[model samples]
Target: MKGRIVGVVLAAGASRRFGARDKLAARISGRAMVQAPARALSGLGLSRRAAITRTPRQPHALRGTGTALWSVGHRRPQAASLRRAVRGARATGASHLLIVLGDMPGIGRAELRALLRHGGLHPAMATDGRSLAPPALIPRRIFGPLLRLRGDRGAGALLRRRPDLRRVPLGAGALRDVDRPEDLRPPRTG
Candidate 1:
């Protein structure tokens, strides 16, 4: 079945904890880390529904092809950015939203598509058998909860507030993201 979900790439973050630069803009496989998530979403046919970024004054390089550029208000937390993304997704008549992170360079398109096929209104979250985070496929039924998100944590907190979360295992790549200088370095070619 076709997933009615639109993809939202959260490319807005301060990266203050990392302290080098915007980690999402850091490179991987000859492209910015943000590009990986953007490409993955494009591959899934959600390119037309994407919100590439929520930071104003960023280089055009950060904005991938066919993605809408938006600012979630500077100095705001990640949840604010998420709220903006969900609103955009809803505006496009999407039944669900696949929230992909800007720093998750290793998330495969197929895995996301698998989760999409199984998505539902009870909050289908991508987990690595340990913790859950984006890329989460949130149904429109949870849009109100998403709008109520706070700080930079995003929707994982919502799962706690609302029981009955459908957990989808994304394996190792789902648990990975570019958070430090070392994280952006290319893995050794064996």
Candidate 2:
């Protein structure tokens, strides 16, 4: 909580399962999917913020969100995008990196605050009690491992194997991410 933390949004996924349309561009509750996470990160006042996307041009939703947009090859692996973010953070002298998925509109300011509050200098990830995932906080010590990550995988597998990883419990619904069209639908009310 005391060090310079850089917030990064990983938005370069191929969205192969979400039909021909771009999942991150899809809207939920009147806002673009990617905008939610980007906006959330912007509100935290991190030392720096960026979004890694597959498009060279900045998306309209992210234009005024205060997150610098970096592009990667659409076919590139998830690790490639992560490496880019890590390098940017390192260049900026950040002490920690907050990794958030652009497709996950469910994770908002509250969930992120909890992760940082409990994370401190240790690697911390959000959990729904059954599985570990991001919006994760990675201290500078683990940036090496993150740079070595390969093929479609982010820090999930690496964090899982770390004994020092802190699991911040969040509501299951808060971890929901958009993969398919139906995933954008609001849950039914009783």
Candidate 3:
């Protein structure tokens, strides 16, 4: 039987490079950048949809996109926040957790579904041919090590330890995360 799958949007980035504005709150295609991933994951009808923030006052838009709000308290590292989100997801009886990045406004429902398909059997993560990263599906078997993660390393450390990560090929759209002002530009036309 397939285990329950939960979605968690990691929205706690400091956006130090974005210059004076939170990238997740920046508008992309007329909507908050975080909304894209939130909607994509929520549309999958996962066991639950949630967003992790560094503080309580971050932004209120994610909640409207159907994601429950969570905070890791003050400016904790991404890994710490993710660890807390994982524990919260497990509490919902989830056997799998889909870690989505809030800044990836181009991620869509189809991409999330693709990750979910392989994630049911083993740990799966999306790859843009250069690196395997979030928009990943982590199985419960590694939840312990995941919870043990600390500092700003995020999940890369855990992924590196396990060579079994199923790398799912994803399009440039799925990999386009908004980190700086230039990233907010409109996509070029064919």
Candidate 4:
């Protein structure tokens, strides 16, 4: 796991749509909403993992194993989250960064590995082209775009402006983010 890419979880949202409570701490089945992404990223063994929260508040339950990563605090805006995330990870020798959302519980470890592998060749965004978005694989060279990203929607436009980038479609999970109480519930199998 030497020199593997860093995985960044963007958990710094206002959670306004989620109503009360820090959505990052909201539980899904047995895990907090934010825990879902951390769980997936922790297994990657990339030597660095970081969660960008409104504060530097990382999941303490997730701490202990040195393999787990740092939590960075930000006082404003989602764009600040990405900028801080990339900068912090870069300080620790991250060659590339794989950004995952705090709300997509369905995104599995296998898919993340695939995303990282595919990301090595292309700077890609995860989407099914409907609603959920912002997850992606970003090269250090593209740090400018990440820093430039602003507003509530996050980095989607940054990817679009870069015509040289390639995108990988990871299906619904890539696009599925939890913004409401209904989002935490499992889909009906029917």
Candidate whose TM-score is highest: 2
lDDT of 1 by residue, 75-180 (tens): 7888888889888878878878888887788877876886776676566777788777677888888888789878866877876566677788887655587777
> How many steric overlaps does candidate 2 have?
0
Better of 2 and 4 by TM-score: 2
Tell me the tens digit of each residue's lDDT in model 4 across 1-190: 2345888777777778889867767777676666667778767767677676665444553454232444445446777777878887678777788888877777767767766766664577665655425567777778766776665446666777777566556777445678887787776664
Q: How close is candidate 3 to the true structure, as a TM-score?
A: 0.92
Candidate 3 lDDT at 60 equals 63
Give candidate 2 regions above 4 Å deviation: none
Residue 112, model 1: lDDT of: 80
Better of 1 and 3 by lDDT: 3
Rate residue 142 of model 4 by lDDT: 81
Better of 1 and 2 by lDDT: 2
Sort by lDDT, top down from the best: 2, 3, 1, 4
Worst 10 residues of 4 by lDDT: 61-70
Could you tell which candidate, 3 or 4, scores higher by lDDT? 3
lDDT of 2 at 83: 92
Q: Mind sharing the TM-score for model 2?
A: 0.96
lDDT of each: 0.73, 0.89, 0.82, 0.68
Among residues 3 or more apart in sequence or in different chains, the pairs in candidate 3 whose N, CA or C atoms overlap within 3 Å are none
- Candidate 2 lowest-lDDT run of ten: 36-45
lDDT of 3 by residue, 1-190 (tens): 2678888999888888899976887887788899999999765768888888887764766757877888887767778888988898889988888898989988999988888777766788888888877788888888888898888878766775677888888988778878889988876869
Over 4 Å off, model 1: 56-58, 185-190
CA shift of 79, model 1, Å: 1.2
lDDT of 4: 0.68
